[model samples]
Target: MEIKTKKFKRDLLNWYKNNKRDYSWRETNDPWKILLLETISQQTQLDRADTYFKLFIKEFPNPETMASSSLKKVLILWSGLGYNNRAKRLYESSKILCETGFDELYPNFEVLPGVGPYTNNAILSFAYHKKVITRDVNVDRVFSRYFGVDEVKTFIHNNKKTLLDRVSSRDLNQAIMDFGSMVCKSKNPLCSSCVLENNCKKYIVKIKRPQEAFSGSNRELRGDLLKLLLSNNKLSLKKIEKALAVDREKLLKATTTLEKDGLITIKKNNLVEINS
Candidate 1:
């Protein structure tokens, strides 16, 4: 069944008008805030992201503020967020934004650290109000099911012009994401209450995969090492192993990975510290 683009869009927009999620970031057109929110949301749940967003905004309200701040300070604020590299990249990107400014960086946002295709489009659509789709996994799932197409990218490539016509890109993207999360969930979708139920060409039911255990994982070990380092200035390799209660080999591997990620550094005499 062919998607009735006009009716589908109208129905989706109408649903969004009433069902859209309220977020503090949604109230502003500030690109910096949107970029920060988007970057933080990449690895965090929305509720937690909101909390961190508030913290970050309060600490570094603008690119200039973040640019001038130390990476150590940013990482300290980003302690519980887990993905320390994002904070690093965000810090680097802020420096560039401060040096060049967003107006000069407009449409070429990918030049900023960690700003990929999805993020670039997100900043454009949400901040600049450009008519471009932010094709994240949620949007992909919604469109793939609605159009009954396995290859969503191909479909979007063929129909992107029609998709963007006469629609607010920001609202449409947000609505689809919300609808995907709330109604067309990956597991246990609420098909009965879906606004596009009749028009949806396929109803894909995905099995919910069990989350991998974080305990005893390398990720946990890395977090432990970083947390310890965050509290103190530095620790020796032997101390880290003893503190983490892991063997020397495992500690070395974790430290090596952390160093490679630019999260920490191991100096002479095997002293480990958060990368400055």
Candidate 2:
């Protein structure tokens, strides 16, 4: 069955108007703030990222502030967020943006430290209100399932421009994001409650969540080690191993990875500290 684009757009926008979440980042049109939120959100869960986003904005409210702050300071605040490298890249991006104007930034958005395809489109539509598609995982899922089309981009590429004046790209993109997150979730979607259920052909496919166990995983050990280091200036290797209660070889491997990632440093005394 062919998707009724007009009806879909109407239902999506109407549903979004009634059901959209009040995320703090969504309340404003500040490009820097939106960029910060999206970068943090890439590596952090939305719920936890919400608290961090508020704290982050309060600390570094704008590009100038973020650009001035040290990478160590940014990482300190970004401690539990995981993927600490993203924090570094975001800091670097801010510095670059502060030096270059926003007008100049968009043209080079793709090459920016953290601004990839989805982010570039996000900035274009959300910040500049350009009529472009922001096809992230959520938007992709919503469109794919509703239209029963595996490649949602093809449809958007062909039809998005024609529908732009009728349905603003920002509204359309934001609606799909919310719809996917709330109703057409990755696991056990609320198909009955979804706005598009009546018209949707239900191209639902089960996705497998990663089975990486945290007990002895490198990520777990690294997190444990960082938490220990965050408390004191440094911890001896023995102390970290004892505190984490992880295998010697696994702990060693995790520490090596963290060291290479620049998250930590080994001192002459064999004490590990947060990298300066």
Candidate 3:
């Protein structure tokens, strides 16, 4: 079943017109500050991200100011978010932007690490009027349900312009993300009330809870392995397998998946470390 992206975009925005959250950043167009929210939000709830975003802007409000602040201060502000490296990346990206001699300004939505298509589009659409597609986990899950494309990464990787051109990037990007986060949930989504239900492939698939198996499945297992790997630099696969105490085969599968995801890399004698 083919879903009309424009129609889906319209429905999402109309729903958003009536039901969007009044976030503080929605009213601002400062690219540097927007980038701050985008980075500090790494795997965290929005309310918490809101608090952190406010704290960060208060400490360093502009690119020139943030470029001067030590990364240690940024990491300290970013504590409890679990991914300290994103903090480092955010700081580094700012410094690079400053040193680019681009008038000590944040670049125009290009030339940013960790600021991929999604983050870039988010800033561009919200901060500027440029139409761009922004896909995060919520949008990815919703799109998968709408189109039944399990390999969403590949589809997104190949069809960037087509998708971005179809949506009202300035409004629809945030709306789609908000719609999915609030309505098109990962587990037992409120499909009945979902505006896109009529066009959703999940309705066609008739799958009650598509993301259920994914929760306790290999993904979570790999994340647990990652927490351990990040804390302790290296360990043999056999040692990790034994420590987890499930089965060597399962441990190998999880470790292999993590490695393939570029979250970890093997060293001498099955030692593993987080990618820098």
Candidate 4:
């Protein structure tokens, strides 16, 4: 299916003008805040991401404050967010930004810890308002469905100039993300109401995958362990195992993984604590 690039862009931007999501992150062009929001939103729901973003921006406000603080402090605020490594990376990246400066890091954001291609482009589009497309799952779904192609990167590369011409990258990216989430959702998409319905090539309902059970999962165990350590300064291995009601081996494996992720420290004295 050949997409009318100009018409598609017009329809997309027009739909966005009426239906775009109003996020606090969208209100500013501050690169630091944008980076923080992008990092927090990764693999996290928008609502929960916003909650954490508020907490983080309130406490840190800027890279300098976060860089000056200890990792343990950041982890405490980031406790319930899961994927605790994100907080650590944010802390590490903040230090780098503080030392090297944001301007110097322009277009090379991947050098920062945990900032991948999507995030790097996201920062450029959202913060710098550069002509770059962020191909996250949401953006990918929208484009893939519209073009009836799995190779979204190739499609974007071919149509980059036309898609972004005379359009604000920030608005265009945010519009696509919002449209995907609201209209072209993975399950139960509202195709009848979608503005691009007529032009959509593969307007089919996506199969929803069953969510993994969180109960009895390693993820739950890891969260429990972190909660325990967050309340106390440190805990003995035996104490953690007993408290979590897990076997010694399971506890050790979880701790090893967490320690490897730089989220916690297993001291020589058989004590575990959030990494400093």
In candidate 4, which residue pairs get closer than 3 Å at backbone N, Cα or C atoms, i.e. clash?
none
Q: Candidate 1 deviates by what RMSD?
A: 1.7
* Residue-wise C-alpha lDDT for candidate 3, range 2-103, written one tens digit per residue: 247656666777899999877788777777777898888767778889989988899888777777987556655665665555776787787886767323
Candidate 3 local lDDT, residue 203? 31
TM-score of 1: 0.94
Worst 10 residues of 2 by lDDT: 159-168
Off by over 4 Å in 1: 1-3, 203-212
Query: Tens digit of lDDT per residue, candidate 4, span 1-276?
Result: 224777777898899888877778886878899889989898788988999999999999999999999988998898888878888899999999988977899989999999999988988887788999989878888887887877889989989998888888888888888888888887767888888888888634355677678888788888889888888879999998888899998898889999999888899999998777
The per-model lDDT (C-alpha) reads 0.86, 0.80, 0.71, 0.86
lDDT of 1 by residue, 1-276 (tens): 224776778899999999989999986789999899999998577889999999999999999998888998998998888878799999999999878988898999999999999989988998899998889877888888888887888887788777888888988888888888888887677888888899887746445477667888788888888889988869998888888799988888888999998888899989998877
Q: Candidate 3 vs. truth: CA RMSD?
A: 7.2
| TM-score of candidate 4 versus the correct structure, residues matched by position | 0.94
Q: What would the TM-scores of all predictions be?
A: 0.94, 0.89, 0.66, 0.94
User: TM-score of predicted model 3?
Assistant: 0.66
> How many clashes in each candidate?
0, 0, 0, 0
lDDT, residue 207, candidate 2:
79
Lowest summed lDDT over 10 consecutive residues: which window, candidate 3? 101-110
Clashing pairs in 3: none
What does the lDDT come to for candidate 4?
Answer: 0.86
